[model samples]
Target: MSRIAVFGAGSWGTAFSIVLADAGNEVTIWGRREAVCADINDHHENRDYLPDVKLPDTVSATHDPVVAVDGADAVIFAVPSQSFRENLVDWAPVLPEVPLVSLMKGVELGSLKRMSEVIAEVTGAGEERIAVVSGPNLSKEIANREPAASVVACADEDVAKRLQAMCHATAFRPYTSVDVLGCELGGAYKNVVALAVGMAVGLGFGDNTTASVITRGLAETARLATRLGADPLTLMGLAGLGDLVATCSSPLSRNRTFGEKLGQGQTTEEIYASTRQVAEGAKSCASLLALAEKNDVDAPIAEHVDAVVAGRSTARDMMQAFIDRDTKAERD
Candidate 1:
């Protein structure tokens, strides 16, 4: 059996640890808070994140990173995207040379680098050993043992396959892919699109509005992905369209939920105070917009979402802006 270290105790990290343990691997989770770690170790539940979900006996938690990372075959980093670099820097000395799995899905604010890139930069890990786990994974559903499929992407096909085997549970299906760039981009930007769809929902719009945003959002996502040398079809697969649909539709999606609040005239500060969780799109919108500018790609929906989240625009204003934009062909 493999030993896996999950370097965050957030919803996704906790849920994924259960997946690995249920797959017959030994899983250790490192949480920043001692109380959360205590809950996981003593009660087998992460009350702060996945409340009411019981973890497997093979899974454990620790506040010490050294204890969590010791002799692990793989290390999964599931912290917030903005804080990933700092946390990796602190944990780097104790990290073994194993497959670094990124559960983060936002571009670094100023650097505009993907989570894998940040991992390599901070930890000095090679591209072949860096992997990303992403798809339509809403933490609550996965924690309840609901059936879900995800893509494990890495530069090396062998590495991706190995990770796929390590986390392959009956309830959680994983597919391997070599298109790491496509997968990362799809995962990162889809949160922003979900915010847009959420705003539409909060505005009392119907299925027609949601469908339009989803289709057009995928188009914009593809435009940027292809520009970055990613395979266009990868954007059509699990990490892309699959992820976008799930995040946009599910009430469990933090990013979408945050946007819904914005649509209902609540401020970003208000939502932040209430949830006490980082809604990735609210934090990554600026960086995503910067990346689009750097790549000379147009991401109108993402731009509008960013403005709204930043308190520079309102949901109604964003919709009107879309209507007033210059007309173009469907594919264009």
Candidate 2:
């Protein structure tokens, strides 16, 4: 059995640890809070984040990063995208020369780098040693062992396949891909689209609006990703369309829920104060918009979402902006 180290004790981290252990891997999680670590060790439950789900017996937790990564066959990072650089910098010295997997799905703010890019820069790991997992993975459903499929991407096909085997469980199926850039871009951009969809929901718009935003958002994602040397077809696959659909449509989605709050006339600061979990889209929208602008891609939805998050535009203003834009060919 593989010894897997997961860094992050949040909902996704805990749920994914279950997947690893169910696949016959011995999983150890590194959590920031000693209470969380103790809960997992003593009860096999992360009551703080995933209180409803029970964890596998083979799964455990530690407060020390060294203990988590020591002798691990692979290390998975499910931390927040914004804090990833700081956290990895501190842990890199203790990390073994094993495959590093990223479960994050947001672009870095200042550097505009994908999580895989951040891993390469921070750990100096070659592309082959770095991987990412993404798709229509909603943590609660996965934690409950509901059937789900995802993509495991690495520059090296062999590495991707290996990881594919490591996390393949009865309820979780993983496909492999060599298009890391496409997978990463797909995962990141979908959150922005989900935010827009959430805004539409909050504004009392129905499926017609949601469908329009979802389709247009996929187009925007493909435009930016392909311009940056990703395969265009990848945008049509699980990472792009599948992820966008799930995140935008599901009520359980944090980004969609955050957008719904904004749509219901709540301020970003108010929402931030209310929720303990980070809504990734709320944080990633600005960086995603900046990345699109840098590449000269016209991403109206992302632009409006970023404006709303920055408090420069209300949800009403965002919907109006879309309606006021000049009519053009749908493909344009």
Candidate 3:
């Protein structure tokens, strides 16, 4: 059995640990909080994140990063995208020369790097040694052992296939891909689109509005991703369209929920005060927009989302801006 170390005790990390263990791998989770580590190890539950779901007996937890990664076959990082570099810098010394899997789905601010890129920069790992997992995954659903499919991507086909085997649980099916760029871009951009969808819901808009935003959001995501050297079909697959639909439609999505609050007139500061979980879109919109601009891609939806998040535009103003844009060919 493979020994997998997961560095994050949050909802997704804990949920993914279950997947690894269910697939007959030994999983060790490194949580920052001692209480969370104790609960996972002693009770087989992450009380703070997935309190209702029971974890596999093969799964355990530790507060120490060294303990988690010691003798591990692979290491998975499911931490917040904004703070990923900081966390990796501290943990890199203890990390083994094993495959690194990133479960994060947001672009890094300032550097405008994808999570895989950040991993390479921080750990000095080559493209073949890094992988990413993303799809229409919601932490609670996965933790409940619900059926789900995700893409496991790496530059090396062999590494991707190996990872696909490691997490191939009965309820969790994973497909392998060599298009790491496409997978990463699709995963990152969808969060910003989900924010837009959530704002529509919070504004009391019906399904029609949500549909328009979703369709257009997909187009925006495809434009940016393709411009940045990603395969367009990847955006059409599970990582892009599937992820967008789930995150935008599900009330469980943190980014969508955060945007809904913003549309309901709650300030960003107020929303941040109310939750411990990170809404990736709320934090990554600016960076994503910046990335699009750097590539000279037109991304009005992301631009509006960034403006609203920065307090420079109200949700209503964002809607109006979209409406006021000059008519053009749909493909343009």
- lDDT of the candidates, in the order given: 0.92, 0.94, 0.93
**For model 1, how does the per-residue alpha-carbon lDDT over 136-163 read when each residue is reduced to its tens digit?**
9999999999999999999999999999
Worst 10 residues of 3 by lDDT: 314-323
User: In candidate 2, what are the lDDT values of residues 23-102, reduced to their tens digit?
Assistant: 99999999989999999999989989988688999999999998999889999999999999999999999999999999
Candidate 2 regions with alpha-carbon error over 4 angstroms: none
Clashing pairs in 1: none
Better of 1 and 2 by lDDT: 2
Question: Where is model 1 poorest over a 10-residue stretch in terms of lDDT?
Answer: 315-324
Clashes of each: 0, 0, 0
Question: Clashes in model 3: which pairs?
Answer: none
TM-score of each: 0.99, 0.99, 0.99
